[model samples]
Target: MTPLAGIKVLDLTRVLAGPYCTALLADLGADVIKLEPPRGDDYRHIGPFQQGESALFTLNNRGKKSISLNLKSPEGLALAQEIAAGCDVVVENFRPGVAEKIGLGADVLRKAKPGLIYCSVSGFGQTGPFRDLPAYDLVVQAMSGLMAATGEAGGAPLKTGESVADLVGGLFGSWAIMAALVQKARTGQGATLDVAMYDALYSMLTTSHALHFYADKTPERVGNRHPLSTPFGCFETADGQVVIAVLTPAQFARLSTLIGQPGLPDETRFATDEARTENEPELRSLIEDWSKGLNTEAAMVALAEAQLPSAPIWGIAQASDSAHARARGLVQMLPHGVLGQAPVVPQPVQFDGVKLMTYSPAPGLGADAAEILQAFCSVDAARFEDLKKAGVVA
Candidate 1:
């Protein structure tokens, strides 16, 4: 049996961070019930649509059921409370106080259920100086100092190519939720998890942040170079650029021999890591002078033979199609109701000999409203019809 087969999750989150967190839970075999507004989640309108449906939304929201309700209405709020009282987990990404305004806040739900695992994912957090401010992935990236540490030296600060802040927030949130679940099993108590996008991103900037904390010096962008380790950056080769990271003295010595600069490491300027770092420009140029004549594959072979860490930069397509990725079953092709076959990244954890597979398609707006209300609430067909007529459920 799947680890989380018996657990049920009430997912009230929309967009990236929160949805991604719930997606992980769903992958672990939780019975996830996505509660949407009458119009559906805002991500449905995001680009890269297929057959008038959002592929982006499908990627993060598969393997869950959807039930639409208008929380503004008293009946709708009551229905949601009933679902929360029965579910093991509730995840929401509304701005601070929004859930409280809708009468579904952690305190209220915890009082009702007593053993509910409620996780709140927001831009800043539930209680903080920036709690109420509106934030996006780019805003969090810039505020967390990640932008300042990225990109070329003296160039405009660049946000990462992907939505790292959002993705990390989701990953951390899921991890925290799982830990809380384990704790609940042992303590017979529930947990209230608060995940903030900016906080998560800032926590991940440890190396650069450490320099400022201990040395009182902020790290500047050096573009693909290690902030502390010498000879740990991209080098130009005949075919393309290859990255090499020779961090230790032994590795440096081996690298020196491999690059035909045997006595260079013993030289005063490049003898130790500190010395090499102090003379990075000259050292890098000397390495590049040798690499510029060798092709990327040949350079990689030489570096590998010398026991150095080096690899060619790969684009998304190349990485996705790589032999290692294929062997590990990192990606899977699943049936998307409207998008035909969709490629989805599987959950990172593998249990026993089984990998989690997609069990259901992304729901159409309110697709399971009637079924859910009937099964969980024991609401008869007549009552469901009445609620729909009253504009409570769509």
Candidate 2:
């Protein structure tokens, strides 16, 4: 509902992590100005294009004004500092020290505006030994043990289907910025946030933490199943796979009845979660015998009728195009000249049964430069023309 209506965010970052955080702020009604080089963000040229507009870029940059500025120029740097002086927050995802080298470091900006919230997104944190090492989603996921804990037990480690590390970093970045804003509101003091992809992704592996921290063991790659629970994985049906999520004894009992073995849970080997996990193979065999005879829908229906939790695995397209997604307003269309309408996928938090916010289409490169410059920097038409002519701005 435009909670951050008057807040200003200067998005100096590009690619996924920085864009994602700024996108969230923009969706929540912050006036986000995405500053890019004259050539624009690399994502703007990346593939999966629709009518020559990069879908990847359009999806994350919605509702933000774009300003193409040449930060390498001395005048451009001064303008960036000036624009940032008027903003509430500035977020960057450059390598740890690059912002300082480029003359827009936290100290410089905080001195210019004491209450400014500066966020830096990186592969590793600013103080860590690995902070100097370059990293990507794949690197973080693999190093943080998320990839190691994924996939089938005997198979090689695997990365998630999506860029989870990057997304997780962005998520924490947004959370930290909001938290800093809250603190600033109370104390009139700014914060310098250091959000790392490695830390964020590693923190998200709760199950991995459970095994490594409590049990002194590495979490095994358990594939689609809940690692410690039996009968909590995908079961094959005649048509496709159905997910079974029987966790508690009550759910397990219902599952037992659904599989035509009501007393199975009472058996010594299957009486407790630990016992059932120790004998998972036998339990899986029994569950499949019942499920394999039915189609996925049939199995799902039968499980539902028995009050057991079950679901069917759907591809991305199938899930996104489902009735539930449409009904919940999970996908909203934003008008775009190139694509006619580009889908804006926002967080799925419902406020009083309504979507949190709606965004306009992502701006074209430097599309809002003049408006943003006039509004924030008080740059007149002549000065704006001079800057553009000097290649200081585009």
Candidate 3:
């Protein structure tokens, strides 16, 4: 049987983070029922459309069912509560107090279903000073000190190219949900997870945090270079940039040999890791002087022959289309009704030699409303239609 095959999730999240968490669960064989409002998830309106539908929504929300409900109505709330009672997990990413205001708070849901795992993915948390502050990926990236430590020297601090804060929050939420599920199985108890994007992103800045805590050193924007390790960053080659990471003394020796500077590793200024780090500017210059004579691919090949670590910096399309990525089943094309086929980056995990893959596309807005209500709520067809007419269920 697939992992989490029998587990059910009530997904009440709209945008990236919370939806991504539930999407991971769905890929793991959970029955994730995405509960949207009458108008559907806000992500569906985002740009980069695929055959008139949102590509962002489809990519993040696959292998799940969608149900639309008018939660502001009393009847709608009753139906939601009823559905929650039957679900194993309920996830939301509303602002701090919005869930409570809508009467769909963790406390309310867990009270009705004692074994339910209630997960709240928020900007800050439920009870912090900044809990109510508006937050997006950029806000968290800035507040978490990620941006402050991410750019080229002397340049303004830059946010990462992707929504790393949101992605990190989702990753942590998925882990927390699984851990809570395991605990529930052991103790017959549920859990309330307060996964804040700010906290999650902060926790991921391990090197920066370590430097600050151990040495009272704030990390600067060193671009692609390692803060402590010399010769462990990208360097320019004739064709393009290539990353050369020489962390060990042996690797440094090999790097010197590859760059045709055989005596450089023995020099006092570049002998040890610390000494080399201090003289990194000179080291980079000497290495790049040789590397600039070779194309990125040739430099990479030469480094590989010397048994040193190096790779050409790849753009998104290049990385996605790489043979290694295809061999690992990292790239997949899933069928979508609107686009016929949609490219999906699946969960990067394998269990017992089996990669987890889910092909179902993101559902249409309220597409499975009647079927879901029939199965979960046990509402007959006539009553299901009436709920639609009453504007309670869409």
Candidate 4:
């Protein structure tokens, strides 16, 4: 059986952060009921559609049942409350106080279902000065100093290629929910969790932030190189770019030998990690001079043979179609309704020495509404039809 087999999650979230968190729960075998708006999640309109289905939506929202509802309606709100009352967890990403204003807040639902794990994912958390401010992933990234710490030195601060701010929030939200679930199992009591994109991104600045207080040094963007580690950055070879991380003295010694610079390490400038970091420009130029003669593959293999951590920089298509990705089943062709078989990245975790089994595709915009209302809210065919007629449920 799956780890979360019997857990049921009432998901009242749209877009990235909250939906991604619930998707993780659903992947672990939680019966996630996605309570979408009547118009569907905003991600449906995002570009790069397949057979009229949003690729972004499908990638993040697999393995969940959809039930669209007009939460503005009293009847719809009441039905949502009923679902929350019976669910093991309730996840929402509405701005702070919006859930409470609509009567679906954690306080009300956790009181009704005493053991429920209620998770709120927001840009600034539920009780912060910026709680009520409207924010997207970009805003949070900039505010949390993540964007400021990216890009090349003296270059314009660049946001990450992916929506790291949103993903971080979702990851932390799932982790917090899982912890709360564990606590509930132990004490038979519920817990409320607040996951913020700003906080999540800030917490992930482990090295950069730690340096500020510990050494009175503010982090600056240094492109692909690590903040402190020497010889830990991308290098260009004859064919393409490769990354080599000589993280320890042993690795550094091995790298020097592999690059035909054995005597260089004995120099004071490149002897230790601290000295090498202080002289990274000269070190990087020296390594690149050697790499310029060898192709990327050859350089990578030589580095690997020397026991240094190194790899060629691969584009998304290359990485996705690589042998290792296929061997590990990192990507799969899943049936996403009219989209047919589409490639999706499933949950990366392994349970009991085996990969978690994947479930069904994301529901086609409330495709399970009638079934869900009938099953949970006890709205039979005629009542469900009436609610649909009244535009209460879609």
Q: Which structure is stronger by lDDT: 1 or 4?
A: 1
Q: Quantify all predictions' global Cα lDDT against the true fold.
A: 0.89, 0.90, 0.90, 0.88
Over all chains combined, what TM-score does candidate 2 have? 0.98
Ranking by lDDT: 3, 2, 1, 4
Q: How many clashing residue pairs are found in candidate 3? A: 0
* TM-score (all chains, Cα) for each model: 0.97, 0.98, 0.98, 0.97
Residue-level lDDT of model 1, residues 143-216, one tens digit each, is: 89999888897898999999988889989988998898899999879999999998999998988778899879
Candidate 4 ranges beyond 4 A from true positions? none
lDDT tens digits, residue span 3-87, model 3: 8889999999999999999999988999999999998999999989867899899989998999899998998998888888899
Native-vs-model 1 lDDT? 0.89
Segments in model 3 whose C-alpha atoms lie over 4 Å from true places: none
> Where does model 1 exceed 4 Å of error?
none
Question: What is candidate 3's local distance difference test score?
Answer: 0.90
* Decoy 1 TM-score against native: 0.97
Clashes of each: 0, 0, 0, 0
Segments of candidate 2 deviating more than 4 angstroms: none
Candidate 3 clashing pairs, residues 3+ apart or interchain: none
